[model samples]
Target: MAPGTAERIARLIAPLRVKPGSRVDLARDFDPRYKGPLKKKDSAELLAVGVTLLAEYQQRLAAQDTYGVLLCLQALDAGGKDGTIRHVMSGVNPQGVKVSSFKVPSAEELGHDYLWRYAARLPARGDIAIFNRSHYEEVLVVRVHAEVLDRQRLPGDVRTADIWERRYREINAWERYLTDNGFRVVKVFLNLSKEEQRTRFMKRIDLPERNWKFSAADVRERRHWDEYQIAFSEMLSATSTKWAPWYVVPADRKWFARICTAAVLAHTLTGIDPQYPTVSDKARKDLLTARRELEAEAPKGAAADPYAARHRSAGG
Candidate 1:
């Protein structure tokens, strides 16, 4: 990382973040087509740099094994969440990252509290976990269509008119608890314009390769777009806490959205600043002894090891 790169990234994303306690009216407050001063041509190079930074930080994070990161992504259909994940995380090692996509609740999941399934899938120490449409779905989707709550099996007393407000507070507190326990929660909402969403949907239908991505149900959900926007606004306002604030990434342009997403994640890991663990004195001594023993046994000629000459030529 270059000097002040982290600070630059922080500045780049400051405008996209939802400040804690701020009221959000998604349509009025954020422009889904906003790409700042960067043009489409700049995305590839910016994203490459972001990927390199992510890879470096991820290695240190894994080696340190002292903290975890959870990325919560929320988006409407055709909002580019999948593509954002694919491009932003392309350079990371698969072993250290887990992506969990949450759909409608399964019978088993509905049997437990709404957060149970999400909590169970949290990242282990030194790992990153991404939730595609996460626990916030409880507030967004269920709030949009209140009838979905009928299936949750909640106690009658708990299903009062103030249920949404209660859930918001509970979620904020839960995120605070995670932050205290060495886990950082990152939230992003892909803010896509209604026009852009329709355009993407048309492409999904017109292109054979993308047909599988389209669903009639997705189109059906379009009818409730206004309601969903309201739910999303409320969710952002209520849960964008200091511990886990939300970034509203403009999703009208896929390339711009990807780079912005990358910046947000890179900024996060940069702040955490995880480092490779330092060995203790006893461990260092054992390492020296092991090195000596290995050196004493390694007497093979160039002919014995096929790559010995190559290693020597490369100064290995």
Candidate 2:
């Protein structure tokens, strides 16, 4: 990557990152509709470039088979998490990428620890895994609806005071462990404004094609918008560690959000600096020998002349 390009992308991403140990008030610290310093057209162009770069980087990462990348996306309804995944990751090789969309846990999933369902979905070395929603839901949604926790059947002491804080600490430690094991966790929160969410919901109702996306339950959850916001703010503040920080991306502008996501992904992969593995000296020698053998077997001049050979063989 060119220095200028790297610097430009870094600038675009810097403000969005929730610094570790800093409190973040979503309303005060981020604008859900922000498009940064670029015009729409410029941003789109940069995003295209970023997509290409991401694909290249992913190829290198896969070929190296040394590190894994995990992208966890969190957002409220109509927040564009699906769109971001579709567009931003469109350029990557499917074989090298795995996407997991977490919905309501099944009986089997609930039987295990909250993170158990997610652990199996994590990327292996040289692959990228995306979580449409993740373990954070244990804190965000489960916190918003405390009753949901009652079913977990945890020890009485584990459910007592400071449980949320304890979860945050656990998450931080878990992410640090992943980093130590060569997995880079990129956490993205698509910050959508309530007004924009309302507009999107209205669109879902008005457009027949999008009608299926509209759910009465989503509207019910909208009533807890303030609670969700507080939950998100606290979550961001607590878990945005240096090893696995959170990027609070603006989602009102889908194009800009996609661009920002691609940029952040590109930056993270570049930071990992994956490279194609070097061939061993013996392998190199064997490759050269194989090349020479294939070269020696190349078709002779008359065999290569297909038209002439056909005529000669036919006695023409």
Quantify all predictions' global Cα lDDT against the true fold.
0.92, 0.91
Give the runs in model 2 whose Cα sits over 4 Å from its true position.
Answer: 301-316
Model 1 segments more than 4 A misplaced: 300-316
| Residues 204-252, model 2: lDDT tens digits | 9999999999999999999999999999999999999999999999999
The digit string of per-residue lDDT tens for model 1 on 5-54 reads 98889888999999999999999999999989888887899999999999
- My TM-score estimates for the predictions, one after another, are 0.94, 0.94
The per-residue C-alpha lDDT of model 2 at residue 27 equals: 97
Q: Any idea what lDDT model 2 has?
A: 0.91
Best of the candidates, TM-score: 1
Which residue pairs of candidate 2 clash? none
Tell how far residue 173 is off in model 2, in angstroms: 0.4
